[model samples]
Target: MAKTNSTAVAAALTNNQIKRTVDRLAALKAQIANLETEADNLVDLLKYQGKGVYFGNAHKFMVTTVTGKRLDSALAQSFLTPAQLLKCMKTTSTTSGRLYAL
Candidate 1:
């Protein structure tokens, strides 16, 4: 009878341990799911919203004129003429520097 009680106790302990492990695993899974959802939300916020100039809106934006100081004299001197710069713009879809898509 003593051996039987010991065996029963061990079996109960094992079952409780297994149940606790399963519960812990389930909670971890739920936490991962929530994290994934938050990650997706953050990605949506960070990525280009495709709204600025790509979408045709009723609002008319002011066309800002480039000041003479804005032009790099050294860089401008590299090109033969403004026509060369215009040609480069026509040929290249994307510029080497930071791109502002219009």
Candidate 2:
């Protein structure tokens, strides 16, 4: 039937689009991972010998010290009562979608 053929074509097109999107996402993930590694290396080199700042021809880098308290969730869970644990917890929801290659 014409309707069946049209539906098939639409499904094929949707699959192709999903594949392309997934491929693009994979490429972007690779690029981001590479950039993160490079950034981490740069940070380590710059932070060596207690250096705080570096001036370059195209970029400026500065090291900042931040102090904060973070909860040790595992330790807290072991020691705290259920009610106490609940008091320390905050719940959040995130919505996201991903396409994968088959």
Candidate 3:
């Protein structure tokens, strides 16, 4: 099928117009993802260069290195039986939502 070229910004858009707009939105999102990925690599390079504050023409950025000890859940589970692990485990509920396009 062909494509629609209705770049209308009214609330009363036709079905095809909405579809075309969604297509444009998805394209823009893809472009943003590509840009963010590229910039993230540069940011990683800055982090590797060392943790310090940096300044641009009008902006300042900081690279910080955090040191902390994290628990190894898999290793701990190996050292503990199922009953012991269950006794030590804690449960929590969180509110979550997601949007899907199909």
Q: Pick by TM-score: which candidate is best?
A: 2
TM-score of each: 0.34, 0.63, 0.55
Error of 3 at 67 (Å): 1.5
**Whole-model Cα lDDT of every candidate shown, in order:** 0.59, 0.80, 0.82
lDDT of 3 by residue, 1-102 (tens): 544655343659789987896787778788998999999998988788787998889987799978999889999999999999999989999987432467
Query: Which regions of candidate 2 deviate over 4 angstroms?
Result: 1-13, 74-80, 97-102
Once fitted onto the true fold, the runs of candidate 3 whose alpha carbons sit more than 4 angstroms away are: 1-25, 90-102
> Global CA lDDT of candidate 2, please?
0.80
Q: Per-residue error at 27 for model 2, in Å?
A: 1.6
Candidate 2, backbone clash total: 0
Off by over 4 Å in 1: 1-13, 49-102
lDDT of 1 by residue, 1-102 (tens): 467546465564567786775677677777998999997885555444533332237643232335575667568758658777666554447645332222
TM-score of 2: 0.63
